[model samples]
Target: MFLSTILDKPVCQPIKKPYERWYTFMEKNVEFWLPDSEWHTKAHCARVLLLALLIGHQKGLSEEEKDALGMAAVFHDSRRHDDGIDKGHGSRAAAYYKEYCREHGLSYDAQTYYITYYHDQDDSLGLSEIAKSSDLSEQAVLLYQIFKDADALDRFRLGPDGLDENFLRTEEARQLVDFAKDLLQKSNETNA
Candidate 1:
């Protein structure tokens, strides 16, 4: 499979049958700073997006919430500079997401922005920020958790201890542990 470095091209090939549409959309639409990044490639974002949607559905999230989750997933690591501890990548991605939405004439979702901004931070910090914020809704908090868990699920690509089920924010995510692993394996095979 030939991956394109052009910003206008799809970031990667679709990973799964059920998620092809989303994978294609995100791969084509989202902008990655490091298109050649091995760890934070478009395939990783697509898997995270799929996990987020599945977990959101299980949690009975509204269409709007799911949309936010989708946006959060695709943009979460868009600004990552390295595969290691790139601490402020989330904030950079959030800023990019805001500008992207504005330029594309899409609705700017605060929930999505917040989720993206704080995703790389500690869970306690994110939760506390949500709790203290006057503008953030309870739904935003849940979306944050869902997005975090969804991103974490894709950590299987990191190796054996990449994912710790106990760290998963939602029960739905915890339940998807085996499935997440399988998804990673299958996606790797497809990409291979």
Candidate 2:
């Protein structure tokens, strides 16, 4: 079934299925940096979270990797000031994620931090930095690519020509283009 089907029903209605936990968690927990933003709201984050998990699963990510991806998805845009190319929102979101995890007594994953911190930056620059950091594992680099691709998949919300398949980091993400467009359309309908 299309993932968008879940949002077709009332937001309060229970959804019992795979990935439902993340869906519920995002609905209850995601806090937008620009709460009133037309483009960067909870719905956008939730869709990214779902896309990340789907791509992560296809890439054989471990539970720990998936955890980092989930965190990155929810917080990556949590600090955006506006929809227009907010250059450093990723870094702000990364800092917020660190503080949030600390306040909640959750373990802070560097992979998550790096992914969120550099997601909005240029891919070559981000990967170059990751390559130079000896502390970051190859898995961190993979997660970064996966997380970015997940975020990119949701670009359909920006309208036609918003997403370019060649820019996606993973073939898995490329495969989801049609589904992403459908999700955005259905999500808009549900919210409207």
Candidate 3:
């Protein structure tokens, strides 16, 4: 088969030694520098990657873009802790990605050479720019949209008690966002 199809054995995680080290350092140190909010947690980033990969794979993103999506998820908020807000997380992510690529033998630039550009909701236009700059047709924008919305879904909601009304505008994101909002409303009622 041209594809691996169902679970074929694990080839292993893609990151090499230097890449692993840089990530380890970044993960270990990023939190103390960030505010103690749900927006800056490692767990949040992990889920964002999972959601991106789920949508990307379901939609058949290339192997490189798939890998870049995960890298982008990790790096999107990598620099937010340092600045006390998400001010330039995308560019910071880009710089960090470039450093990681250079430090290792990787052959791509985080900014100009990859399909995934790590961006926060605070950097929505950057997300739009990355999607436009990529080789995706209109349909593939759906993949990027999923990633963007999924991350936004996580940010504006946290379990059954968290919901943000403004995020429910798009039909694509409506189901997830509405479900969360309903759950939050139910929980509030129950508590009341």
For each candidate in turn, the TM-score is 0.87, 0.88, 0.56
Model 1 deviation from native, Cα RMSD in Å: 5.9
lDDT of each: 0.82, 0.82, 0.50
Q: Local error of candidate 3 at 133, Å? A: 4.6
Error of 2 at 77 (Å): 0.9
Better of 2 and 3 by lDDT: 2
Give a tens-digit lDDT track for model 1, residues 22-125. Answer: 56667788889888898998888877887887888788788788888888888899999998889999999999999998999999998999999999999889
Superposed by TM-score, candidate 1 places the C-alpha of residue 98 at a distance from the truth, in angstroms, of 0.3
| TM accuracy, model 3 | 0.56
lDDT of 3 by residue, 73-163 (tens): 6666655655344565666666766776787777663333232343444336655665666554454345456656657655544544344
Question: What does the lDDT read for residue 176 in candidate 2?
Answer: 84
Error of 1 at 100 (Å): 0.5
lDDT of 2 by residue, 78-145 (tens): 89989899999999999999998899898999888889999999998889888888778988889999
Candidate 3 wrong stretches, greater than 4 Å: 1-38, 82-85, 109-118, 121-124, 131-143, 156-192
Error of 2 at 164 (Å): 1.1
Residue pairs in clash, model 1: none
Best by TM-score: 2
